[model samples]
Target: MRSTLRSSPQSTPAFSLIEVLIGVLILALGLLGLAAVFPVVVRQQRTAADQTQGLIVARNAEAYLRGHTLTTTRSVPNASVPGGGLLAPSDPIPEQNRRGLDILRYQGVTATNPYSTWSFNAANPDRPGPWEIPTYSLVYTNPDRGNMLVAATNQTAGVQFAQRDRLWPAAYSSVDTRVDDNKYANEPRYIWDVATRRVDPGTPSNVGDDGIQFAVFVRRIDSSIRVSRRDLINDPNDPLRLSRPTRDLRLADVLTGDRLGLGGVVTLQRAEHRVAVAVTNNSNSPVPTLNGEGEYAMPMRMQIEAIDDPDGQGLSRFLLPSSATDIQRRLLREPGQKFVDNLGNIYTVVKATFDKNPPNTSNPPEVQPENERRSILVSPAASANAAALAASGDLQVVFTPQVPAAVHVFTMEPR
Candidate 1:
């Protein structure tokens, strides 16, 4: 009887095939849900990485800009070129792209042109809308940066005299017998003549003919000089300044002192407080040579500093102090002050000096209507009465591009 009961109970112990299939189906559904969400998660992570990379690139660029001073001209040295120290890339991209940095330049003080504008959505040359145009110069050794050639005269003969080998016969007389031909007589004359190979001395050195003839020849030695603004602008061979403007304008005339809160007055003594451009040559080629033409590299630290009034007075009489008195009390009350912006927005100043015209008088006589009498007089410290002031005086605008530590990136877009 026990064995029969045990066998009957065992028959109901195992799960049905349908139940097993249902369990498998539940497990499969969970896996399917996980699979569907996996791609979205991965995409999100990739997007985050791209954004981080972009920010890093921008920051690096800014840092570079801030560290360097602003200059009318820039030079990217051949030595700065990566890999090929002597050859610069024809285009700024690929080299800059791989580095995650993009460069843009402007010819004038203000970047008003579309080509000179910087944007993140600029397209490639072949693409539409967003486009980037980066400039690069061919790499060459700069002879101006102390890499110069000097002609050292050595007296190889017993009675050696200095004789300059003139490249331009017209500038130097071949038959001039009165010139002293001694060791120091014609020893490569002026520095310009030696470096430029120009024989034009404008004046000739001559003494009574005294059979004191010396043989002088030029020998190239290395030296260098700092690049100058005129050199970059006047050099026809330089690609960067080939189209630079030749017009002359004083710095004071170009910048409005009033806008900078400098009282519309310019003084030479205050020149130190004014902003001045600093030029740097990153090019491998030195100044006075056309090899680095059209190559200007901007540093991150370039900035402009001008005068600014912290009290917000000193520009124009339009910004002045006003008084609102309690007529019944006969006591000087709150004075009104207003600051106007370029957009015609008026801001009220809470506290100001209050003065009574009729001292000790209980009731000061009213001159005109309250609206008309309330004159927005300019303070003595205010600069100009012009609608908009040029960015000038104690004010400083530092253009420090944010560059990232790990990467370089250039992005351009429409304004």
Candidate 2:
């Protein structure tokens, strides 16, 4: 065999400098593309997150308002409390830790920025001439006790004796002036001054003398009121119902009555009584009574009752019939009312029976001969007598939102 010089195949030369540069250039371009896309992705994610957070805050606020009934006492415009606005009467109750309403005073909404508002020292000694934001005068009273009839003194015998003594008078007597003079002298005066920006001297300045008194109380929506008519009808004794059956089927049937359409009557049985109560509108208006066929009256009692689920599933449901519409229109449909905040956020009130009956029960249960049912919508407007209730600070009720940071506060005056 010829030992041919088998020269090993020489290995190819390594890549040229130009080739190396090209490869690096390609890699750099790819890296640049990735860098460009990263910021866009991050921005989109951040925007989505912000929108979701804002939506959550809004929905939480709406649910909170719907879950509990609102009254002038607690929902006072620009009311203040320890955390912010006026504190609800139930604020002191331990059980209301999570369920109480928060009066969210909306400062304003910023598209891509944090929200801010004018601030002042409520207790600042140096700031002169009352804080810019008017302070509220809240007078709370016992509607039952303050307005109850009392034996008149011998001086006024012919007239039926009336309990002229107010449990929570809106203003302080000259002898009992505690807050500054410019401040509301009484609960009623305070609320009136704050709401209407006008001072009012309540009628009959003397104690034990009939005069306007106002009070407001705040209470959570008791679990009993949370149940729907169907649920209550099915299981009247459900612990969630928060009511009792004092009598047999006859009494139960009579109390519930045929108008309700449920075979058995569900008796709330003073459930309203057990609710945390507060009063507002203690200031005495020159008119004395807020008149409008008793409709659209302030200091109205807000009662909430779960209705028979239209879907028949025994659960409460809110439906939007219109698909292409704004939130305000949806919330203001028939059987519903719209409540807009200062920021123009709209809320709706769905129509439902507050009690087993279509209408509310007379305040004094005994006053009605057969416990007549009344519709809250159709019931007489808040009585002018409510002015007295307001003066005592008994008519104002405070509604505090659960999330303090998200609520907007503003005033809604009578139209």
What are the Cα lDDT values of the candidates? 0.23, 0.25
The true-versus-predicted C-alpha distance at residue 407 of model 2, in Å, is 9.9
TM-score between model 2 and native: 0.22
lDDT of 1 by residue, 93-142 (tens): 22211101121122211123222122112232111111111123321112
Query: What is the C-alpha lDDT profile of model 2 across 1-415, one tens digit per residue?
Result: 7787655657546788999999999999999999999999997785465345444434433333333222111211222110112222112222221111213222222223221122212232121111111112221222222111111111112111111111112112322233542222332110110011001111212101111111221111111222112324235454433443221222112112211222332344332112111221212211111111110012211112222233333223222212212322221232423222111222333442233332334554334332232211211122333323333322322112110112222332211
* Full-model lDDT, candidate 1: 0.23
List, in order, the clash count of every candidate structure.
85, 79
lDDT value for model 2: 0.25
lDDT of 2 at 68: 27
Model 1 regions lying over 4 Å from their true place: 1-9, 49-57, 70-132, 135-415
TM-score of each: 0.22, 0.22
